[model samples]
Target: MKATREAYGEALLDLGRLSDQVVALDADLSKSTKTSLFAKEFPERFFDVGIAEQNMIGIAAGLSLAGFVPFASTFAIFASGRAWEQIRNTVAYPSLNVKVCASHAGITVGEDGASHQSVEDIGLMSIIPNMTVLVPSDPIETKSIINWAFKYKGPVYVRLGRMGVPDLLPKDYSFDTKPYIFKKGKKIVIFATGIMLWKCLEAIELLKAYDIEPTLVNIPCLKPFPEKEIIEIVREHDMVFTAEEHSIIGGLGSMVASTLSRSYPMKVSFIGINDKFGTSGKPNDLLSFYGLDAAGIRDKLLDNIK
Candidate 1:
């Protein structure tokens, strides 16, 4: 059964009651971002800043300046491309305590096609100076990390999805305000992010059939990237495989490969959407079409490595 993004709605609603300073803002996308519950519960704290993403960001920054921990929501495209200048100047430049929650990220936005998909959002946010990037693998992780961001005092851009995904991580799994390590192995490490984590998990199951147990690391916090841990793990492994639902150019796989090539010098098999923009289809159809599914990921990993 497919999970719903609405689970994030349940989680954020619970989080709002726990933090007095928690404020929610939307760029005409409260229902889409699953933040409508946050608005319904905390009417006074929630604000819909119209369709102007740049101005919405300004309002978030202003609210943060007034000591409020603001969580801004919008589709990934607008939040990154539309409000980039405002985000850079108002939130990141000042190192303000603002949280940006971008939903409908990656090609998973489906039938809406590439225009609605924000394939490079992760890369865009991760490169921002002093901006912390968090990409949760599933809805459960999404809630915990969003809650954790409240305690973190800096600008954060968290990527969420419009599509429902399997809960790959355990329900009790929590971010330690630090990177969390899941699978441990020596031959090869499969480091995955976002919805692709589940795909990697399936790949692991297939690899195990051949007795190949690759290490699987989940980097929920992509920025300040668990560099120390990643380096340590890569040193022990013979090769690496990085995967994500976004484009192969700038998403998780590219980030990992670039980091390893310079520092560790190990090979990384990247499994994700190639350079082509995504097309309109069912989410599952898109997954298979874009080679973002588990079986597709398994095929790629198997073909490249032993």
Candidate 2:
């Protein structure tokens, strides 16, 4: 239940039960993205568009126009890049209700390296018009947000991690897509997403050891990055650090800083890739190599706090 695949699988079943209008399309990634649950339960509602990611989105758009709520699934890169034009014109431009469900996002898709990895997917989707991008922190939150996308209008890009993520949400917890503050603090705010939540947890422990009780905000929904909530948190804390396992250019770090500067100004530091392509290393090795681990965050915190 803690793995993202389980949440996607369970939530698709829940969505299928809740709405007769719900239909799914996948580009030969049924097993990977867990859309097979829906495919099995409602074969008629499921469309396996073969390995055609572009056709997948285009068909999903057609389904939307036909009054069916289409949730498209594939690896992040192909969904965003392979079918980006179709998504932009057919879905986003028209403001259609389509959920682009993506998996194996970020460096978490280790060993596969940069080729299969999708470090830029979040930035790519969030920039599109009428797109509500989501990067859920854990399995429970993944379910909550995917359920949110079900009821949410317009186009949505859901970026899901491939690895087994720790459950950061309380059992029987509720989530509002606007903004849900997992932990609050006075000095520093840790705004983290996907794969990097575990790092934030470790940083929290290290910070507590150093008497720096920081706030940890597990930001799954990155596109509509809780604008008001972020500004308030920034004002409440001495400083805020945006952390994610992505390049700082257009990832969570960049998104947070952009929101803060316009809505509310706050001292912010970014903790992520120093604008580089990730190498084919062990996950832990990659994290340490890019200074995105617990110790990396701790060091960045110390540097900025003083």
Candidate 3:
């Protein structure tokens, strides 16, 4: 098992070696965000904007304007919540090449409590114009997405987790803006993102006893959403469920529901944190408390499909 943030650190190192213009900025969170790896190697190119998330974003925007691809890092809460205006105006509005890679997102942030956990970051980033939002399910996908973000122009927000997750993708996997199918089944479809994909995989095993097989889809890209593909797949299914370690209000659940409501119009239910903030606890316990674990998901599926 490996955390996606670790892969992000490794990817940043690779980018540093590949390009001179690839600069990293952190809000005095180099170690936590793993930008320390890049700083250690390229001190001159790395900037630690001391406990100032907003200033880090503004500096990144300036770097982008100077023809440098700047990757800014910090906790999801501060990156999206604290520095929101700078990101929306300085980076996104101009369609600059700034990659805002926020770590420790969702309920899995653990022990840090409600104030640190950022279940709304995805929604915040997605709502902005010219911003691309991505949630990588595993370490491999995380690395691929980071590499892709560096190459793609404009503002991009890649949400990363703190907890370790089982590697689900192949070694040869490449990143793209499409949903990945992990299993094929009839009538029902379960769309999941981030660490929730692993939970859904676990739930699928429990569901097998009842012959309740659902087509499992991993949605790594949440913005500029895979709407056409989602509509096509939803049309083939009887029931739909979107799972995420985020709030049901404006995260993955909202995106999927909004898309289908306009095009396919299906009964879409969600398995995620409701209208509540995350509390301090073990990651697994927090997931269970929010009905985001394997068993909770299984129960939700069984209850909803009936």
Candidate 4:
């Protein structure tokens, strides 16, 4: 198991070696966000902007204007909630090639509590017109998405987490705009993002005892949502569920619901934090407390099915 943030760090280093134009900026969180690896390897290319997320974004914008691909790092809450305006106006507005790779997203931020956790980052980034939002499930996908973000020339928000997740994708896995189908089943279909995809997979095992098999899909790209692909996938299933380690309000659940409501108009049960703030607790314990664990997800699915 490995934290996606670790993959981001490793990928950032690879990017530095692959491209000299690649630069990094952080709001005093290089060690946690794993940008330290990049900083260590390419100190000259990295700029630590202290604890000022807004200023860091501004510098990233300036770097972009100067023809550099700057990847700004910080906690998701600060990156999305604190420096939102700077990101919106400075980076996203001009369609600059700035990568805002915020780590420690969702309730999984753990013992740090709600103040640090960012359940609304996806929505915050998604609402922006020129921003692209991504949530990678595991380390492999995280690396793939990071590589993809470096190549894609625009404002990109890649939400990463501190919790270590199991390796789900293969070593040769590549990032595609379409959602990944982890399992094939009938009737019920589940769409999950980030670490929640791993939880959903666990929930599927519990469902097997009841002879309930649901198709599972991993949605890594939140913005530029795979509408065409989702429409095609939903047509094959009867029931739909969207799970995320975020608020049910503006994350994967909301996006899937909106898409289906307009295109196919189907019901999508949401499995996520019900607009509540996180509290200090062990990461795994917090997941269970919020009914985001395998058993909780299974029960929720069964409740809807019954």
Better of 2 and 4 by lDDT: 4
In model 2, the clashing pairs are 135-220
68: Cα error in model 2, Å: 1.0
lDDT of 2 by residue, 243-304 (tens): 88777889888888888889787767888877777678776777777787889888899888
Worst 10 residues of 3 by lDDT: 260-269
> TM-score of each candidate?
0.94, 0.94, 0.99, 0.99
Q: What's the true lDDT of residue 248 in model 2?
A: 87
Cα miss at 195, model 3 (Å)? 0.8
Clashing pairs in 4: none
Across residues 1-306, which tens digit of lDDT does each residue of candidate 3 receive? Answer: 988888999999999999999999998888988999999999999999999999999999999889999999999999999999999988899898999999999988899999999999988999999999999999999999999999998799999999999899888889898998878988899999999999999999999999999999999999889999998888889999999988898898999999988978878899988989889999999999999999999999999988
TM-score of model 2 relative to the true fold? Answer: 0.94
Query: Candidate 2: where is the Cα deviation over 4 Å?
Result: none
**lDDT string, candidate 1, 143-193, tens digits:** 788778888999999888888787767878877645456777768888888
lDDT of each: 0.81, 0.83, 0.93, 0.95
Local error of candidate 2 at 281, Å? 3.3
Q: Model 1: runs farther than 4 Å from truth?
A: 1-5
Best-fitting candidate, measured by lDDT? 4
- lDDT score, candidate 1: 0.81
lDDT for predicted candidate 3 compared with the true structure: 0.93
Q: On lDDT, who's better, 1 or 3?
A: 3
